[model samples]
Target: MHDLIASPFLNSFVVLRPGRLEGIALPERRFRELAQSHGSGLAVPLWLTDAARSRWGIDVAPRPVSHAVHIRDAPVYGHSRASWEINLGCDLDCEHCYLGEKRFAGLDAEGKQRLLLILRDAGVLWLQITGGEALINPHFAASCRLAHDLGMMVEVLTNGTRLTSPTILESLTTSRPYRVTVSLYGATAETYDSFTRRRGAFRRVTRGLAAGVEAGLPLRLALIVTAQNAHENDRMRGMADELGIPYKEYTHMSPTIYGGAESLASQSPAHLKALERFTGCNAGHTFLHVDPHGRASMCKVGRDEQIDLMAEGVEGLVRLGAIADRLMLRTGGCSGCRLSGLCSVCRPLAKRYQEAKAPLNTYCQHEQKGDSG
Candidate 1:
């Protein structure tokens, strides 16, 4: 594998290392030239060679384009990003998991390969492979390798339980994803294991994290703060700080994907933080999500409408933009709500909250206004 990856990120171009975070931006013209030079046996430009050497300490001199560079071609589709759930299987069961019922099921090998290629053809440059615990998926290594070979910057969303496995570590070290994001439950085993309802999970996760850091893998942490472990919030932050890993905290717990209120029970009533303003998002316009069965949706939360990739293939994504539009409309319980414009949650999320019959204070400003009779 080449030490660096040169690819088109939507309308722009980037030159980045596979396992490291540092990267360089390349002008479109330069990117086109490099891509077109592949078959011509043209040597890589000195500018890139110099940048790689100075920035990443890798030498690419005296090597032709075919050998030195892996330039990914621009896609024919307009979409640029996507996330896929390889499977719903998980080792530990967290109380706040949005996927309430974690079924260990997904597409077979042939179906997975087909779905990945469809993602590439649909112009997904940045892909996130998530799961109940993505690492536990039997096909994870081969599927991850296929995604990289397809020229997509892959990020694995894992639980960190398997990061210490020699086979898993070797696979990741070899192909090297752009990032491996691990979820942080708590600072101590008592809190973590209790929150996940699994014994010895905290030790396994810490060991995995240590192994990952030692291997110089690009790792990020997602601090999941829930009622079960909210007291350790400070300790969790401290752990990330001590590890020198960047982290984002998730304080609010949402309803399950199946519109059940099970996950909301785990919300930390006193610790819930105000969410950032919900400016509009480009869910289906620029990004989409796919379930394990190759079913595509506007995003993770907005799964009301879906496209069956296995049946219609990538061309089916043409309808995703329209689905996004319909899903975002202020209909159903939100219809004519004066606070629609300032609502903290999107329409789809609001719909899920409505379905779950969650407390109004959890998602709406309407609760404060009451019904003005």
Candidate 2:
């Protein structure tokens, strides 16, 4: 019943009660000593009772404590945020879409509401609604309102096409989404159309950004980099500056969730290699991705293992954690590699290469070059 906690993101442990996480930070060494002395049987740093009393205003008392569950041993459910793909439909057809040609009939309005309730009851605080274009869904606004009513923060990930319509704009204003993230394919109509293959989409999306800004809604812009539009990265940043909206750039692209590599040709191997190591994946730990048909997985990249949410509900979600725990890459190649720090490749992607019987040429090449030098 002690209040020490470990942070997956910070790689550091802290002592605090739930919902009041602002507590004293303990050095890893001190924490480990306390944990060992207390026989907590957990790896997290101990509560540092003396330091807690003087520095963090924590009340320290001597009391016999029972066994402590390792933070990693705790169930992922009710602990992390989630990303839900409300629908698979989109107005623009980007060649690099991870979904590829996969399609599914999403839940009805009632079903979506029920799902939202379950997520909220499960202690999921943040719900990111995404899709080929979430705003285009018929029940998009209503779903946002429902999520808001249920005490979950709602973030809408959209292409921005539907936001330009007055009716849609009105609904968005009323629903008051916590935030809206618009994906900008390119900086101009020609470049955007080249990537999206949808004429006039760039104009619609830009207009949508303006409307959202004018409506006083929080908006974030993300430039999706591809071979066709990679050269326009600067222009995309300028566009975001011009609009005075927060923006980010995404350059790495994963093979389609369906295992199609058509878009892989456009990805830059060097750029991919230079990418930061993915430390916290949404998978079984604290995040889940539910596709249109209610099939939930750890994340979009690792959707190979799935559980039917509609069929199993929360039980299905718990099963997903079990599935992710059991997912491990083949050992020989990556098991003990010293280049783990420099290598951005993950188990799921490694498994994909193994299945294809193709060595991860980029990674192997980098390793060879490093060894030679």
Could you give candidate 2's per-residue lDDT for residues 126-194 as a string of tens digits?
A: 578999788778888788777655545567898888887877777667655557888998888999977
Clashes of 1: 0
List the global CA lDDT of all models. 0.88, 0.66
Off by over 4 Å in 2: 1-76, 102-104, 268-273, 280-282, 328-342, 353-373
By TM-score, how accurate is candidate 2?
Answer: 0.73
Weakest lDDT window of 10 consecutive positions for candidate 1: 364-373
The model with the greatest TM-score is: 1
Candidate 1 clashing pairs, residues 3+ apart or interchain: none
- Model 2 residue 254 lDDT score: 59
Q: How does model 1 score by TM-score?
A: 0.95
